[model samples]
Target chain A: MSAMIKVNLDLLLVQRKMTLTELADEVGITLANLSILKRGKARAIRFSTLAAICKALNCEPGDLLELDKEAE
Target chain B: MSVITIMLPALLLYVAVIVWLFVHFKSKIFSVRSGTASTTDNRLTRLVYHFLDFFLMFIILVLLMMPPLLVVMTISQFDNPEWGIDIGVFSNLRIDLNEFAGLVMEPSGIRNPEFSTQAVISIDTYSLFAYYLFALISVIGGVVLLYILLQLRTVFASLLSDMALTPENSGRIRKIGYAVIVWSLVNPFLQYFGGRAVLRDIAFNVPGFQLNPAFEIPIVGLFTGLVIIVLSGVLNEAARIQKDQELTI
Candidate 1:
């Protein structure tokens, strides 16, 4: 069974009531990158980017990511 | 020397290389091995790359004999043994074999002795044009090789700094693969025609020993071409992955 690293960026963005563009601008990243993270397509997330994202949303790393144990 | 003797080691080498490749990439065949793409270049590495580029250019020049007078000079050496000139550069040169075609090994009349039956061929006279015909066939094959090497030069140039995942590099590699496969497919038939041309109208003085001409397929070249094409696909994937990783942050 293959375990996927799932992204919860969309949930945190919703709870924070922040648009993707607003988060992108505040984090100095592109909306495209946020979109990729939201869609679980990004192969990796850097610590700096993760820290910026956490600061913007006021969430821990666990709040933005999950271990998807379902076989895919 | 017989063709089999010359080819035995080459075939073995090919098998060994294939085995080594499989072993080397056992589980990572699908995954591109990861390492930091260093921007640093030592002087020695740069010098080696430059030297290789020049060597390739020189080889292409050698393959492109405008008048193919090299063939004439080679045949001349055969005619005049006193010349004893070394023909190392043009190792692929084909000499005339028309008039000297009366070659056949007779089965020993008695039980095969420890010493094999001696059937030495001593050529006294032969047609000169036969050499030209064979050499011409070889030259055509060389032309295809020349194209492959030229494309490879472009590849090396492109890969010096940038990776080999560019559209131009992909196109060049595909073209080289096609050219190599074409050369492999056509080489044997060229030999067949060359053999027939030389074998035609040739009289045999020996009673029962007409030497059968042996021709070979370019297995090594064909395999290499296939491998290059496969690697080109891998390179394209690697390029895509690289782009994805860059945007992952």
Candidate 2:
């Protein structure tokens, strides 16, 4: 089964006009980890991390993450 | 003269250490800390852990050397009358100590000896190997136990940091539990072999001591292993809950 929750970190980063590194520095996370989150490679992301990312990018959780309806 | 001089100080030190530990544990920092991970508690835990690690390392060293030491010491006594064992001393290779104290205290050349009764022990390459085999098996068991302890230490460390419900820790616990169970199952065979190794060779004229090759199965170890494995399922569920908690935004 494919992942139902899709990370829209790239779109949010683009909308904020920010580099992943810059967001990482602002969010107090490593650039490598930010890259993973942006690439949707992370198994799951922490709420605190997502909150920090949302806070840094001046966006809501919905803007950064979206739920793909589960496939039948 | 030498044994008394050396032993007196050593015995005094041993008693002192035991008393100190009793007092230390009875004192405030080691015992009274109740609620959570205080700095003092962490320090105490680390001190205990460091001591355990050091002691285990020392035991491992002794275990590693046991087989060869047993073979050499046992084989050395083949020609020596009274079957005395050598204690390696500084600048001396052959510092022999007899099992019975009367032999050591008395002057050479027996003039009306009190203890004439001899306890004869038969030894061949097979018997020596048997003894070596027992020590080697003990060493192997001890090494495996140490490996399990290392894994346990990791799990315990994670628990201390409040990461007890991680999937990695669950796996480590499961593996340790299984290792313990396996060791328990295998213990009887090792015990049997160890006892059988030297049991037949020893013919006792001395009273109050009996050698028996009784199989010792570790029922407690097996039970403990089972309990841990069963409890790991709860940890697995807790890990899932933690993962869900993490995923919540």
Each prediction's interface RMSD?
1.4, 4.8
Worst 10 residues of 2 chain B by lDDT: B86-95
Clash count list over all predictions: 2, 0
User: What lDDT tens digits, residue by residue, belong to model 1 across residues B1-249?
Assistant: 444554465557557755755565444333432464544463334444555555555555455533444444544355454543211111122223332345434445645322312122223324555555655675687677667767876777666655657756777887888888888888777665655555553564553334433356678989988988887777777777776676678
Model 1 iRMS (Å) reads 1.4
Best by TM-score: 2
**Candidate 1 chain B lDDT trough over 10 residues, lowest sum:** B86-95
lDDT of 1 by residue, A1-72 (tens): 113888888788888898999999999988888888887777788999999999988989998888997845
What is each predicted model's overall lDDT from 0 to 1? 0.63, 0.65
Q: After superposition, how far is residue B65 of candidate 2 from its true place, in Å?
A: 2.6
Query: Model 2 segments beyond 4 Å from truth?
Result: A7-72, B1-38, B84-130, B156-165, B196-212
How many residue pairs of model 1 clash at the backbone? Answer: 2
